[model samples]
Target chain A: MSLHDCRKAFSETLVALAEADPRIVAVANDSIGSSNLKEFKKRFPERMVNVGIAEQNMVGVGAGLANGGLIPFVCGASCFLTGRALEQVKVDCGYSRSNVKLCGMSSGVAYGELGPTHHSIEDLAWTRAIANLTVVVPADPAETSSALRAAAAYEGPVFLRLSRMPVPDIHPADYRFEFGRAPWLRRGSDVTLIANGTMVARALEAAALLEADGIKAAVVNMSSVRPLDREAILEAAVAGPILTVEEHTVVGGLGGAVAEVVVQSHPARMRLLGFPGEFAPTGSPEFLFEHFGLNPEGIRRAAAQLVEESARVAHETHPVR
Target chain B: MPPDSVPTDAAAESVSAAKMARRIRRSALQMVHAARLGHPGGDLSAADILAALYTAVLRIDPRNPRMPDRDRFILSKGHCSAALYSTLAEAGYFPREWLREYMKPLSLLNGHPDRNKVAGVEANTGPLGHGLPIGAGAAKAAKITGASWRTFVLTGDGELQEGSNWEAAMAAAQFGLDNLTVIVDRNRLQQGDETERTVGLEPLAERWRAFGWAAREVDGHDLEVLIRTLRAVPFEPGKPSCVIARTHKGRGVSFMEDRVEWHHRVPTAEELSQALKELGGGDE
Candidate 1:
């Protein structure tokens, strides 16, 4: 499997799309180098706006640009873009329903060595709480390109959460991206492993491990977190216990979203795997994932435990039946 | 030019503006009193500026508020929605009857301005320090497209305490957005206390000038000067313009003028009658 940086695909696709659309403009808060906007600036200098280290102002400016009949792709570090400008996002874009594309780059623990301050574990929660804002987390390069295109075409506010950590291409070259839909990467019957972003690749590998242990584990990639795929979740719940894996916190991320769907539609047992609502210690992205039990082996172990526990509960409830 | 520079038509425009200002204040007071909640002080204080812009200055079509070439106006201090709604209604943006529904359940006239719900509203702004950045962005868009239309934003003096405004102020200067104009409603009072005592925005015009904008001060209640100054775009070449309009917290209502308690207080029946009498006559 070849590793790919989604930001590269995103930047390339943005430049190509901008060539066809004059209204497409890139707005950032002094993050051209980090956001991979150098090439975009070179190709379309007139369309790039770099607000110096002001995330709130950048977001407001994006909304204003949209009001002036221009499409603005506001890019910044995930933590500051969402944390510092949450009110601007809530009022200017969400409540006002401005057509601004907010690109949150290096989301989750992708900036691992920088410690907890840079980790965007809380971004999903923050953005998902706002109405009229679509939150999308693409798993790989192909999905990233497709999601960016879709967001540009959609006439409303969208938060595109992108990771800086390199992830392997899991989807086919011709895979079509659809909003509010979760696609099954690998199907099984015993249990379901739901994940997104960097965790999707890990979940697939975990399913392979689970298959070796005589367990049929289904792998579903849930990219669009806000307008979730409730039907898919309900279908997956009928099989067995669902294990939700993510690079975010256990609360208010993909796990929380799936739980919300399942609890309301179909009550089922599940295990949520991610950061457990605390600041992570300094480490690399790989180390952080390993330390947090997000590796393939760790996920397989958790899945086994969930299946075993559910079997015990079922047996206890109906003895000799 | 000095801060008090007056235009040739100052006398005639002032008479007309004073009448309009009185009506606006009366309408705003009535809305706040009827709703039993609102920032009457800011509403009353910003009446003259709103009247001046909607009547004598803004190049807008009431019939077509979203015209491509029409100028944009954003009220940053959105707690003054009563004044904005009354001004918009008086200018025929919508029926005056809508004023009666102010702050009511499911009313189009929200507590703050909502651009989507209201016809003439350019942006939904309730939070402070938002309008300037948006206005700067609009100006930048016009510059990029090489369009002739301009953008204007009004913010309270206390609202400048938010650092986002300064960030946008820097961008406005850095981009050389000459098509943008920010009028600071220097009412010198916030919700709790005086702005200077709260956070100190003195040497205010100088602060704007230091940020690379063409800064000027004017009497906010003087409609002729306000209109004349607004007509003078750019103030200087290659720079954004900042007009510091010195105003009382509550201008027309004698009891509420410059009082912090009236910042978010509704007028009683007797006080409402007194305010209406002071403005001109009984409410329309």
Candidate 2:
């Protein structure tokens, strides 16, 4: 199996989509190389729009391109794309309901050494709040391709978060992607570890670690955050306690969205894990993940805690079972 | 330019424009008064021009608001939404009774336009400086498909101060969107201060011309002039048209004209009576 970065998967999948549909265009804020769009630029120069360092204009132009009968994949570093051009995304794309795909590359603490200014830990929270916008955080290279294809086919505005971290393939090559649907990777009656993007790899690793300690954990790759996987989430809650992990703020990102669904339906005990609502200090992405307790080991510890809590509650409620 | 010399057809369209202006003003006032909240000053300021576009100039169908071949009109300064909602309703996009729900919680006629909720609203534009670029894209789409549909966008003179508008302005010129027309309601007032004092657009006409648009100035309140100017669109081929319609911040209402305080401040009952009297035609 090829070890692929989500950025590479994003570019390759985009190139494939562009070949299949002539109306597909790539719009970047002078981050073609960063967004891994070199092959796309070479193959179809007219379809690649490099709008320099102007983030606001880049988003607006993407909306314009979409309105001009072309499906535009607007790509840029996550920080600038979401922060600088927030109003444009809200009005030009979300409000207009234009067929534009906003691809946020190198999200979360991926640019950790570049400081908090470069971090995009708040993107999910910000975009999920907007009505009529679809938000996706792909877990791995295969998921990246699936997400890209899904965004292309979806008829309205969508935000696709692609991580820079190198992750092993987690889904089959022929996996069919569906918008607003979560993929359940592992089925178990113990506890559920729900995650997306870079965190999914960590969550799968966490489930493996939990199994070594004689504990069973269900792993779910919750790629779609906006139109959350309600049925899957409810089932998971009913099966056991729930633990959500993501490379985002815990307030309004995937964790918050999942909690909203679970609380409404099942009302189960759950653990929310992510950036604990603060700007992280200067460090490498690995260091930040460890410091924030979001790596595999940390996830395993959190899942174990939830499992024990759920088992204790069940034992107290029904001693025979 | 002289008012009579302004090129307009003195036909049924012109008569409709006059009647439409009266209906729009009445509906806008009613909506604002019903909700007891709205930016009535600016709504009144842009009513006449919106009337001209809906009744006389723009090629749109109330029945098929989403028809790909129909002309598009985007209200860039979306805060003046009562005028837009009233104009759209009067033009038969939706029932006029819908105006009664304006600004009510969950009402389609929000403080700003929502394209999904309301018919005939080309784009959602509350946060200022967004409609032009979208309109430019619409025009470019028409060009791409070789369709004759045109795109019209209206922005407040104060709205041009937003940098996003300039970004769209540069792109519109770059694309040579000859089918796009941008109308500016130059009422010379912002919320708290005059537009000139806040951020001057004094050499505004020259600025747009430098940006490669065919620029013209006219009286915003003059229904006949507005009708003519909108029809004589794309004043120069291969360039987008910009009409700077000089207007009073609060036109028609006696107490509100040129008053910066009235930019969004609601009127009292006595004041509303005076305003209704000035707009003149009794209710049908």
Candidate 3:
């Protein structure tokens, strides 16, 4: 699988979008290189409003730019953008309904060795809680580009959760991203695997492994966490049990989002795979993913367990006595 | 070059602004009294600035609040919604009747200013330190597009404790956002204690200058002085302007003035009547 950094797609698409629309602008908190905005700044020096090393100000400035009739992509490390300036994200972007696109770069545990402080594992939880802000977690470069374009086209505030963690292409070359619509990547009936961001590719691989083990595991790339794909989730619940995998904490991330739907609509057995409460210990991104069972083998095992649980629940509910 | 922005006669404008400021004070007092909840102290403190801006400075029309090139005004010290709403109402952003529904169930006049709900509000700000960066962004946008529109933001001096203000201050100066002007209502009081005792922004003007703004101080209650200072913005050619408007917490009311207890305190009917009398209104 050829690895690709989605931040590249974020900047390239942003530059392309800015080239076409004069209203498109970029706001950064001194993360030009980190946010892959060097090309953006080089191309449109006048458009890049870099509030050096200030996340709250950066987010607020983005809202201000929106108020001034410019569509601002406020790019920063997801940790600072969501965690440090969560209130600004809540009030300025969310409550005000500003036409701002918050580009949370290097989301989840992408900052491997930098420890928990750098990890943006809670961004999904925080941003999704805010009203009127669209939360998007793209699985690959194609998806990232598509999502960015969609966010620009769509009015109001949006938070684009982009990962520095390299992942292979999940969608086809001509893939188009629709907001709040979850697409089924691999169809199955035994158990459904729901994932997003870096976990989607891994979840697909896990589905492959589950298929080898004769367990039919469906894979769904649940990217847009806010306007979540409820139809897809309810449909999946009917198919079988649900196993959710993410690069974030098990609580209030993709798993929690899925759980919120399942518990409300269709009751189903589930297994959520992610870091549970504890901060990521010292390790690289690969080691951390492997350690937390975010790998293909771990996801396969979780899916198999969920499949068994689903079968047991079914058997318990109805018997041929 | 907005219609009715430039003052042909400063004295006459000041007289009109002073009367409007009194009406704003009276309206705010009535709202607080009616709602039984509001930061009346801050409301009274900021009434004159809001009146001056709405009447003489901002190139905004009440008829067309969202005109593309209209000058932007943000009440960053948004807890003083009574004053802002009164000013907006008087300026005809909405009817004066909306002031009666201040903080009522599902009222458009939320405790904090919501730009989505209000016609003239530029930013939804109740949280401190949010307005400057936003104003800086608007100013930066004007500079970017070469638009002649200017952006003005009013902030409570005590709310400057939030570090986000400094961050935007640094950026505004760095970007040379000359179109932006920040008018700080230096009431010198917060919720608990005096701002000097709380966080101490004593060297305020110098601090703004250090952050790369052309800073000055004015008597916040003087309508003519506030109008003149605000109209003469961007004190330096290539820098953001900071006007430290010295003010008392409750400027119009006798009992509430400069008192910390009145920060978010509600006044009684008797006090409202007395305050309105002092403001030269009979509880209208």
Compute the lDDT for candidate 2.
0.85
What DockQ values do the models have?
0.73, 0.40, 0.89
Q: Which pairs clash (backbone N, Cα, C closer than 3 Å) in model 1? A: none
Model 1 alpha-carbon drift over 4 Å, by segment: B1-15, B281-284
**How well does candidate 2 match the true structure in TM-score terms?**
0.89
Residue B152 miss distance in model 2 (angstroms): 1.5
Please give the clash total of every predicted structure, in order: 0, 0, 0
lDDT of 3 at B176: 91
lDDT string, candidate 3, A1-321, tens digits:
689998888888999999999999999998999999999999999999999999999999999899889999999999999999999999999999999999999988888998999998988988898999999999999999999999999999999999988899989879999998999998998889999999999999998888889999889999999899999999998877899999889989899999999999998888889998799899998999889888999898888887787777778889658
Superposed by TM-score, candidate 2 places the C-alpha of residue A187 at a distance from the truth, in angstroms, of 3.6
Query: Can you rank all candidates by TM-score, best first?
Result: 3, 1, 2
- CAPRI level of candidate 1: medium
For residues B253-280, write the lDDT of model 1, one tens digit per residue: 7888999999998899999999888888
Fnat per predicted structure, each in turn? 0.59, 0.43, 0.81
- In candidate 2, the residue pairs with backbone N, CA or C atoms under 3 Å apart (3 or more residues apart, or in different chains) clash, namely none
* Cα lDDT of model 2 by residue, B1-284, tens digit: 11123334646566777777877777787778778888888998998899888767877778888776678888989999999999888888898888999999889889999888898887888887787767766676566557787889999988888887787777778767899999999999988788889989989999999999999999998888888788888899999999999998788777888888877787777777788889888564
A1-321: candidate 1 lDDT, tens digit per residue: 789889999999999889999999999999999999999999999999998999999999999888888999999999999999999999999999999999999999988899988999999989999999999999999999999999999999999999988889999877878889989999999899999998999999999999999999999999989789888999998878999999899988899999998999888999999998989999999998899899999999999999999999999999775
TM-score preference between candidates 1 and 2, better one: 1
Cα lDDT, all candidates: 0.91, 0.85, 0.91
Scanning candidate 3 chain B in windows of ten residues, the lowest lDDT window is B1-10
